[model samples]
Target: MTNILTRPGLKPARPFFSSGPCAKPPGWSADKLAVDSLGRSHRSKIGKQRLNYCIDLMRDALSLPDTHRIGIVPGSDTGAYEMAMWTMLGARPVTALAWESFGEGWVTDAVKQLRIDPVVMRADYGRLPDLGAVDWSHDVLFTWNGTTSGVRVPNGDWIAPDRAGLSFADATSAVFAYDLPWDRIDVATFSWQKVLGGEGAHGVLILGPRAVERLESYTPAWPLPKVFRLVSKGKLAEGVFLGETINTPSMLAVEDAIWSLEWARSLGQGGLIARSDANAAALDRIVEQRDWLGHLAPDPASRSRTSVCLTVAGADEALIKRMAALLEAEGAAYDIAGYRDAPPGLRIWCGATVDTGDIEALGPWLDWAYAQAKHAN
Candidate 1:
């Protein structure tokens, strides 16, 4: 056991481990970002060029198929997802799956706001509901990875290839960290802040051919605000997918995303996934060695590689807070506490942008903080 009186001799070089707006790519600095698009209208020729370039780079990095269309939207992942729910649902029987706080939010939207009367499936944190039980005839909404719960579907094998209804995935934290089967997904939404470690308030919405067909053919009973409108005068808005945004976007944020996307392009999808896997493996080694620390998600196959959650022995809200504060004050880690809505524990970001060395170094500091908090209590 680590002694409470002895502080760890080593510290992580970069202590940022927040789940959202996660640690920036290694060696990132504001001076490195391009500023040519700043102080200019997003509708200008150069603005559209930069925006389109960003989309192209993302597509290249993810190897997204040409059969799908990608667009930049005003709201973060939430905005993009809500846009999908408001427009594409209700045309068919709907099913909403919830395993964590964000997933629950989607259920609320489907049930209360949209009043779609979706067949709801739910599981407690750290476990996934039965994928086999899902109805293929109903439009299904689910998160590819549960950010707060640290649980994820193992693969896309469960989705029906010939299903009549569309599949909407909230992939905010899963994209770029895992290999996503694009054919299984019809509509996907994410924010640059998660896996890419870029700015927030901007969202990326991807639409497969089926999703586009629904947008053009089906009309919802609810009134859509201009930002959520993807169709105009009975035709798909080609401009939105091509670089013309529904609303004004933050050019600085777009530039920041482009910088990260360029970094991702250099690494390639395999390299990015490798970095995330290595970081998660390093963290796993630390957890395996300590009997007091156990994964919140026990099953290895369904565990999240990006946002990994752990349960501390005899931990409660106060103890977890004390440990987090001690670590932060010692410059060992920041924002390592569990999500507010989750069970008391520690949530670490092991995404592609985080260095494996930092995660390896975090072990001793976590021991020191845990010991200190226990001794104090």
Candidate 2:
């Protein structure tokens, strides 16, 4: 067992692995800000430049086509998703697919908020929505990766070739880490603080041709908040994607996001994906070595490369709590506990920011923590 000093008034021994607002960019320094934009209006030329740079780098990293409009909107991923739901959903029948919290949020908004007649397809926390049962003839809403459950859609093969309705995807956790079939996705939204390790105040909205067409033609039934209004002057506000916010944004957050995007560009998209996959594979190796533990996601092929969730088999709630507490006390890990709504499991964010060395160190720490809990029992 690793000699981890339990609670000894010391800091955490290794990196944390919670899902969102995950670990800061590796070696990121707060003092790097040369000109702070705290007091400046977001409409200023400098502010717009920063905003546009972030969008451009994001597009380059994601390889988004020039035809698609990218918008930096409010409310993180949730805001972008709600805006899309309210703006373009009334024209067609909506189908919502949910297997985790984020997806559930979209479903709730579709059914209650927008009052859309939705075909709800759902699954337990550890499973995925039945993709086969989905009718793509209607506008479909789904999350590419279920962050809480560590499950993801393996590919876009399930999407229909001749489907008329748009496919709205909440790809918050799947953006850079997983391969997104851009051709099939319409209004795909993600946040900066996810896989790319950026600040978490803005949502990145990518509107494909079909989604933009819907936005141009349909008028929402509800009142549009000034900030959520993307179609201003009867045209899609094209500048919003480049950095213009419908309302003012945190310039500091915007700068940090730009910095993160620059970092991603240096690493290249393939490198970013490789980094995430390697980190996840390292965690899988640890899981393979342990017989008492297993992945929370049933199928190996459906596992998430970003959010690595695993359960302690035969380990009850009390034991799991003890193990988690001991690990935190030892300063080996923190926030490794699974989501409350999810099955008892440790959810680790093995995104681009997390190093494989940290994950390797966590393996023995888990064994030690488990042993300590079993011995105490």
Candidate 3:
């Protein structure tokens, strides 16, 4: 146990740990980014080449199959997901599974905005709904990992191998951290800012052959926004998947993503997953040794390897706020407070970019901050 009155002797070299726009890769520097694409039209030869290269890099990183088409969309994960929902949903019965904030947002979109009246299945934070009870006849929407609650589906085994409906996964935090079963997923969305720690404002949407068929065959009851349109003359817009974006994208952000993606390619998908697993394990070891600290998601099989949420003993919103503030003030951690919608505690980013040594160093600081906050209260 650490003394409440004494500070930890050692500090993390890089203390960045936000769930979104997470810590950059080791040895990353802004000067290393390829700036040749900056200040150039996204449609220009070099710009298009860079964008296409980014897509290719991501495809290789994920081992995504040729059956899926990847495109760089306008908004981050939210935009890419909404585009999928607006365009491909309502073709059949729909089922929406929500266990966290972002998942609930998709439910709202389906029931309220799209007015699809999807069969809603929900669970409390740190828990997952009954996957076995899902109806495969209905199109299924789910988050691969619950970023806010730190819960995740154990694997794609729950998805029916032969199903009438499509599967949509909001996989922003799970992409690089897990080995996703591409054969089971019909559609997926993610942003560069999550595991890769690239700049935001751009999203990547992946559509399987079934999703593309839905786009070409079935038209939605509602009007598609110009930015959301994936079809031209009832044909899938092939150019969009080939580096032709639906709208203008920040070339600088694109370059930044390229740098991160290149770094990811160097490590390979298994390497990225290994890094995240190691960081999460390091945090888990700290939690095991501490009586006051515990994981929000109790099930180890379903617990998230990234965006790990914790439960502090006898903690309240105020105590958590104070503790987080104290750690931030000490330069020991940053942006580690749990999500506002979630229960009060700590949420640490253990993604591929974060070093396990930093997570190990965070343990003592957490004890110090918790003790200080408790004494103050």
Q: Per-model C-alpha lDDT, please?
A: 0.95, 0.82, 0.95
Expressed as tens digits, the lDDT of each residue in 24-49 for candidate 1 is: 99979999999988999999999999
Per-residue C-alpha lDDT of model 2 across residues 79-117, encoded as one tens digit per residue? 988888888888889899988888898888988888987
Off by over 4 Å in 1: none
TM-scores of all predicted structures: 0.99, 0.93, 0.99
> In model 1, which residue pairs have backbone atoms overlapping below 3 Å?
none
Candidate 3, residues 248-336, lDDT tens digits: the string is 99988888888888889999999999999999999999999999999999999999999999999999999999998999999999999
What is candidate 3's CA lDDT for residue 324?
A: 89
- How displaced is residue 267 in candidate 2, in Å? 1.0
Clashes of each: 0, 3, 0
RMSD in order of candidates: 0.7, 2.5, 0.7
